[model samples]
Target: MRPTVHDIAAAAGVSLATVDRVLNQRPGVRHVTREKVEAAIRELGYIRDVAAANLAKGRTYSLVFILPASDNSFMYGLNAEIRQAILRSPAERTDIRTIEVPAFDPAALVSVLEELSREKPCGIAMVATDAPEVRAIVDRLVRAGFPIVTLVSDLTGSLRHHYAGVDNIAAGRTAARLLGRFLGPRKGEIAVLAGSMLVRDHRERLEGFTSVMAEEFPDLTILPVLEGRDDPEIAHMLVADALSRNAGIIGVYSLGAGNRGLIRALKEKAVDRTLTVIAHELTAHTRAALLDHTIDAILNQDAGHEVRSAVRVLKAKADGLAVIEAQERIRLDIFLKDNLP
Candidate 1:
């Protein structure tokens, strides 16, 4: 039989109410009494029943997750994950709400954060932009005791408690390595497409790609980065322009959303499978592109995994409990055409 709160109270010679107060860290318990209750807890190895405690408290953590309002398949996938989380809210006792802000707008993100701060949700999850004002807003939310988690893109010097995303640097490095090897020591220029330099994920991916290309694939020249803003039309135009200008382009690395444009550009150039293409995110577009030979390899971070991790971490932090770090660690999922999932 597992030990209960009553067992802990009795062992400590403390009242049930006192034990509850001590366990919850509620006010009014003296230091000595709290110490005694804690000692008893240690002696008996008493583990609090999280489910029961939550049920007794009747606490439903209200959580807000801010996502980019982009029409890209990646954002769609992330929104789907958020909807799935909402469906599971009753069982988890979480009131999860999603807010979509304009993509690549630091001011819009900051405004959303400010508004959410006023509403005072138990937790906030944001796909952060690299802006000082945005980081300051997140810091303010953290100081106000809100558990903040950064999803997809992280804000540097923010008070975010956790980051539910993959190591983009590693993902970039992997992409470069794969593309470099796949191109077979070719001496040609590679075009790099990014959503925006303001996004940490994009920046990290670019950094990693640059590092690997410089060290191992010095023969391959990297063209200037094209900011597509994760827009299909923008990506298409930029890629088409680059292809028209750079005939020696043998590889392309897209470290952002909006592969639609990339696909169109490649198809137009009649080099869909000829150039070694590496991209991020495993959406339907990219998946199909990979199958049809538009993209060679994909380095992905599961949007579902990231959303769920943020929720779990937020709930744990809201309840003043420790999170399972290993469980919450996000992994980079590499996909080839043969191993599509």
Candidate 2:
């Protein structure tokens, strides 16, 4: 049989109340008594059931999610998933709330993080901006005992507890391979569309895409990245202008949001030209584009899965328990027209 609190108390020559205080790290137990109880726990291999104890105490974990205020299908999908998680909050013993900050705004994100540090929720998850200031604030908050997780977009170098998102570099590399294979023996320029270089995910994707293209497909020249800020109108204007100006452009790789604009641009500008296009996210626009052969392939990370993983990791961190890494690992899902689900 497993050792219980009673066994710990008996082995430590302490009362039940004393053992409880020590186990919960609550005040009132003397240092010596705490040490004795800890020693007994180590000796007897006593494991505290954190879930049962929290349930008995009626403990509710308050968690905050910080998202970018980007007007795009991917962001909309992510918000919908968060809303679904909110609907299930009662059963999960979580109080989940979301805060939106302007996309690519480092100062605004830092201010929000500072405020959240003061509010001191049980855990925090954010689609990080990937700026030095943001990373500094995150590191400080983690040092101050906040269980922080990076969602969707991760911080490059920080003390964030976990990242509940796909490997963006791998996703980008996959996009390159798909586009390269689709464009078979062609020797023309490839245009890249992005939200912004400020976010780590976009930067990493661009890095992977460029490295693979340079190494394997030396015939394909990559044009300068068109930064659309993840806005449909901006992406449309930029992509349309790029295609109009560059007649040699043979492929499009959109490793970011704003596929709506990319699709519209491709339809309007590349009417006579046969441009192989690959994009991210499987939204309504992208799905239709894929069916119509406007897009050759799509690489996606499930918004619902990412949100759920964030909540699970946060809850486990709040309860002082270890999370199964394999369970929390979010995989990249590649979708073509035939594989759409």
**Candidate that scores best on lDDT:** 2
Question: How accurate locally is residue 109 in candidate 2, as Cα lDDT from 0 to 100?
Answer: 95
| lDDT score, candidate 2 | 0.92
RMSD of each: 1.9, 2.0
- Candidate 1 residue lDDT tens string, 1-341: 77999999999999999999998789999999999999999999999888888788888999999988877788788899999999999998999999989977999999998888789999999888778888887888898899999998887677789999999899889988998999986799999999988777888999999999999999999999999989999999999999988788999999998888988898898454368899888877888999988889988998899999999999999877899999999999989999987
Predicted candidate 2 versus true structure: per-residue lDDT over 237-266, tens digit per residue: 999999999999999999888888899999
TM-score on alpha carbons, each prediction: 0.93, 0.93
Q: What does the lDDT read for residue 317 in candidate 1?
A: 95
Off by over 4 Å in 2: 28-33
Superposition error at 38 for model 1 (Å) = 1.6
